[model samples]
Target: TKMRSNGRIQLHSEDPHQLVFEALLNRGTPGVIAVDDFVLKDGRCDNETYGTCDFESDTCGWQLHNWERVTSQRISLPATDRSTRSPSGYFALAKAPGGRMVSPLKWYHAAKHRCLRFWFFISGTSSERLNVTSVVDEDQEKSLWYGAASEASIQQWFSASVNLPAQEKTPMVVFDAATSGNPGSAVAVDDISLGNTPCPPPGSCSFDEDTCNWYNAGDLTNAQWYRHRGATVSNLTGVQLDHTLGSKEGYYLLLDAEDTSARSLGSMQSEALTLGPAVCFRLYYVMRQNSGASLSVGFLDEHHYLDGRATTVKATTPSQWTLLQVERTELPPMFTIIITGRTEQGSSDIAIDDIDVRSGRCTTAETDPEASMPPTTEADSPATSHVTEPMPSKQPAPPEVVTWQSKTTAAPATTEPLPPVVCKRGEFKCRTENTCIPGSLLCDGVYDCLDGLDEKCESGAQCKENEFFCVTRTPSACQPRSMLCDGQEDCVGGSDEALCGACPAYFC
Candidate 1:
């Protein structure tokens, strides 16, 4: 069952209405389980509630931006250079006090549901002080939250409208950045983008044209970082490899096809390349046995056809060059990534290049934070996207450097140990979705919390005083689950669960 190309190509920005689908895996690939780059290095994840890794800032080396679109003029937008962070401070627009804020790929330690946005840049006199938080899964003190900032160089875009509740006492949404009047000024932040609102080319979802060509199931090509995409021989000098790294050090576009018409879907010349929001794909050909061959890789925006055509996976391994990855959401804005070698009953040879195009992560759930958001609601939220609207109140940025004394790393978690709590009620305020046990109620059965863990039980089923039944069988209902953990599974597994219940007492 190994014939997947995920067929994708979607990442559009000048905002046509936003669409999404071309993917790259903040993590995913052939065998991709490669962990242990291990940098929390001296003791962490021992799991206190996941808040360690003093690697602090400088973010591993940065570079991890699959996508983002919060608005506030990231200066000149189009960015993708990437960074989990670089710091200094000064920003505003309030409202962000919980559900996702740790840092560095995989979202440091917390992020559930996803979709929170922000960005701030400043020019100085803004002495420093910024601390915004979002810790959902690594739950210490219940999903924390914070927010605050004075001003300088100023540019802003803060939003939070959905997806929190992965657990950790749940309520860690904090922000408190401070600044004086002009001391150093150079605070940049391209952060806090929670998800959903990604279309109009927001990742190139679909285009549909197929006779003149316009097939974007999501594949616009341009992953170009380490460089890799259907290469028969990147630079093996002349072609050497037999041992893994010599001869041809790294070259593999090998798939010996003989039937299935030698499946071929490489070049359709739909304008010579420029159609990937997802069309369709197929690689790895094999039909070289009784002259009966197979080779495939076909996509159709238009060159003649009538029904969803894309074949090349009929009898399996023709000798293997197979590595087909597609994402398919129906993109046809001029499509063609063909390579078809067909054989109804005779000669076949299916051997194609190494065409790689994978990138997808765009959806978390949100619907508020001031104008310009229509990346995906199916449609209807883009009254405007060049971004313009703030005269009613909370959207008047571009001023701050009101100094007092400071340094920078966004200069204001102060090193953090936790416990400051002011979190917006709305003085033009913001921040408040770490909701562990405030006013947002509905956990029934009793014990609002002297320490019943929040009610509802099952596994060991105890009813000490509030009707404890740790055995709702497991569907106990918590709303937004998955702090990881579901091997054989159970609800909201937070430390991946092992403190007592849902099977981790030492397996099966």
Candidate 2:
């Protein structure tokens, strides 16, 4: 089959066993065209019911155009299927000269929220790509996710979660694969599930499989968080088992001091989160005796600036994992949790696992009074402890109060002189926090201010001619028009990459 320049498909056959070849073009109505002995069915999986497919025995009601259900033993592309992790397990596979496999149409309401989670494996060349799209009315389609094999390893199976757009009509989910004619290229998908929830809840991580979106701040020159399962390479101080599973099989984020010089600091930041009234952050950590490492947690505004004093742990305990909880009543609306690990002389390792963020204040028994102590004014603190200088202010000064609790003595609050803040022109000053960000970053779908004041623009606000407004996101956002169809989801609803032209136009 060949795709013509006029956007029509031409089918040809020369085999003697093939007697006839017929072509029919429906000019008016749009529909699926079946050839040979193939047939198309509704294969409905309703919206109210949970939809899932392991692909163990069959396609599980999905309509295959060029995709096929095969076992890993039969195809050497993916070494093992994610569902069963065995060679005999079945999975959907697509090869070169690619086509699409689509799910049955399901009724979706405009108000309902759902997420599609799946594990996909891609191996071979960079020319192979997979796209997940939502199609409605047989023509209109929105890209949910698209990527090439270059972003992942050949044998590793990566998990993905995409939020399905809410549409009033019946929409079919499509998995379209396009590949170069290289025989080495292939794509595999398995363990697909659709649930009525968000893809990932904010600030929750176990590090059992992936980093859960937590990323290194890249501030330290030689130190960063490493995901490890068993003991450290040095086998000198790190935890032998993870806190989550209490075994060597489970993974945790470890900061090994053996790889870096003494006093090196490393930090990891979580994804952005919106905090409610009272919030509690909890995690499990291990700090061995003579480790000479201090662990601290702090808040970073959306612009990646540290907001307030961090909760630091100075003393080391036994090799066992310890639970720590920090509860705060006053916090920025949009902030990210930053965990910093600093190594002093003789430091060995510091590991953390099972970080969680939730609503409501922590119980009295769980809250530690020492956790609320102000950060030390030591010069060797992590870079995240230093807040950006604030812009110059002419407003009236208010009395600042500082208070602390001690078992031996009670101290009264004392007023101190406020430091002058200065910011360059075209920078927006955060009202509650002493930080400044570029004015252009305001109303850009990201919360650049600690108090979220930068995102307070009215809906459908006007943008420059070279900008595209993201109407689907709350408060809307303006982004550069060049981001459209860039194979990256810049807008909240993926509007930036949706409705792109077919790939065959360029690759063919």
Candidate 3:
């Protein structure tokens, strides 16, 4: 027997074979179980629903009966066109702001291979926000997916997958949608299921889509790395990585530490990696220098053990692409790579790209002294560094200087008065923080201030009249409306694209 193009099965044999085929079909093939598909029957939403709304459960199974805020007579369907419905209809959150829908809880034996899959529709002027969370345990709720408001011309369907943890029972899932009070702000969901398959982590990210699961910590408010493709930068000297035009590669991660206050320290970490027998990590980095700026790269073991190497280049080290490589032979249960940058004043513009984490070990057994440094008193540290000025024209570019010792020789303390700070070319002083930042960054999308003053520019005031305001952008700077939803994040927190369905834009 074979499947025909006309959508029928052709049985080459007769009655005896038909009996056997029917029996085999009845037994069926083992596959993923259908947990919940969110299908509505007879266009009716009633009490015995797989998904229940927060409002009256008897009136609607998967959606709110009415807008709690508005007195409208018409009931809203998840989508305008019934043809787009997954089966007949889908569960849409209430149109009113803060609407929520809870999926019925289910019990499942926990294993590493258990995974969740779902499809959702997002569209309208005030595209609604959707949050998908899994309740692994009472206190341990994990956010598996988040989608921002979108402004697409038509409804869009997105399929998402999430990997469940290795061991746990009573796993339940929930879908919540936020409303914007506009018909265009519609959030609908369908096709949710569970399977015995694990989702694999991305082996690399080029800053092409979000931060690729990297999280930021340390000095988050005033200093940190941001995904850079196009947008401007400030307070930079010498040859700095292109903030808007991009690096040698089109997109890269940037840390604009130049022009900040006294001391700025920040780090970006990758998602947890379940290592193979061995692992090797490689990345390319470029750093513009200042007197006290330094960058460190390391990995955190499953035991929260930090093994890192710190290196500081000369103040005049040429800004060019440099490859940094490291590997670990003895693999652990899980580990994450962390890149930390430190600077006194804003003197570093660092860019990183082509992060490749693969299954392999280092070519050579290289020992990092900083990785094994014992905790010691700062008083026993090496003497402060005394850098000599390089001769103009006669001085050739010096090689990058890496300090792997656990303890770095501190720069001599300054006794001279902290004079009125000066900003570099094409920069301005954040009078409040006394940090100089780029003119383009003044209102590009990020808040570049400690007092939150940078984002305070009014649309018709500090921000150009023609520019649009990212209400949530720190320092709430102005950006040309053309940059909004043009496929690249121009606003610091990515508020520019939030209304177009990209979300939680990265900011330090």
Best by TM-score: 2
- For 1-508, candidate 1 gives per-residue lDDT tens digits of 1122111112223555543224334322222222223232333233223322222232222222321223234433212212222232212221211122234445322323332334344333324434444444554332222223332211222211222334333344443333343433233344333333211111111111011111111111101101112322222112223111222344222322211211121122122222345322322222333344433333433211111323334333323222333334454443334343333322342333223222221223332242122111112111111111111211112112101111112334335443323211100101233223321121345554455543332322232333322111112223222322233223211112222333322235
TM-score per model over all chains = 0.19, 0.41, 0.34
- Model 2's number of clashes is 7
Which stretch of 10 consecutive residues in model 2 shows the poorest summed lDDT? 398-407
Candidate 1 or 3, higher lDDT? 3
lDDT, model 2, position 496: 56
Best by lDDT: 2
lDDT of 2 by residue, 274-346 (tens): 5544667777777766456777776754334345446677545666566655666666655667787776535
Q: Least lDDT summed over 10 consecutive residues: which range in candidate 1?
A: 218-227
Over 219-318, each residue of candidate 3 has an lDDT whose tens digit, in order, gives 2233557766533254353333432233433566776655243225556766546554466665555655434555555555432234222223333344
Model 3's TM-score against the true structure: 0.34
Candidate 1, residue 495: how far the Cα is off, in Å: 50
lDDT of each: 0.27, 0.58, 0.44
- Backbone clash count, each prediction separately: 178, 7, 12
Error of 2 at 218 (Å): 2.2
